[model samples]
Target: MLWFPTLSKSGFRSFIADNDEGSTGKWMVPIPVPDIGLIWEEIEDAAVEGRILAAKKSTHELVRIIGHNLACVYCSASDPDTVAETLRTLREIGVDGELKYKSDLATFDGREEYLYSSSEFETLLPRP
Candidate 1:
């Protein structure tokens, strides 16, 4: 499962994608926006199970889960400390991966917009 974070009027939004073949046969699942604690709990759980592929923040930060090649894009506005803490936890749990920032902010204004990140980070997502 992959968790993609985005922002909404209510709060943070996480869209989960079950990538297993024949599992629900859906591309993504929209889950209820939980508080930061719950979000981290979920991440920890996924990490323990070794099922997380990637995680993204709405602030344009992306975390790619090593080996799995899963890319998670976070789209919610978050404080630096929160971001740092999350990354630290991931690292402590042995979820090795690189953190990437969006390269072109202007290109992310709409759903049709293609996501482009810095050269340091590679994305499985295609460029528009």
Candidate 2:
């Protein structure tokens, strides 16, 4: 059930297309990142703050990869050779768990907050 951060386009598409039912649901890929991995949450917060919600590309990719693999262990099925490269590509595109920012006030349309720098995420976020 451990899931990796990135996979190829074909890999991604194949993952989500899988169909099945059992102890593992169709999209039951548990995020393997540490500490509940605030990546997705942070991304949502970033989008809402900027008032420009981003399409859930990475999330969908994960669904796809898991679906295609038809197994919760999508990350395990990943080819280690390409894992690093794919992660690099994702990072470059701001799709790699990076709460990407854009400077377009027209899109901002009011809802905006100070950007969440890496150093500020833990502090800025309310403790549960």
Candidate 2 local lDDT, 1-128, one digit each (tens): 33434322222222211211111111111333342545445433433343221213234455566543211111112232222332332233333233322122211334353222222232333333
The TM-score of predicted model 1 comes to 0.31
lDDT of each: 0.32, 0.28
Superposition error at 28 for model 2 (Å)? 20
Model 1: lDDT to the true structure? 0.32
Each model's TM-score?
A: 0.31, 0.22
Clashes of each: 9, 7
lDDT of 1 by residue, 7-106 (tens): 2233433332222111111111122233333444555364345443334332212123332223342332223333334344444443343444321222
Off by over 4 Å in 2: 1-35, 51-53, 57-128
- Best of the candidates, TM-score: 1
Error of 2 at 72 (Å): 21
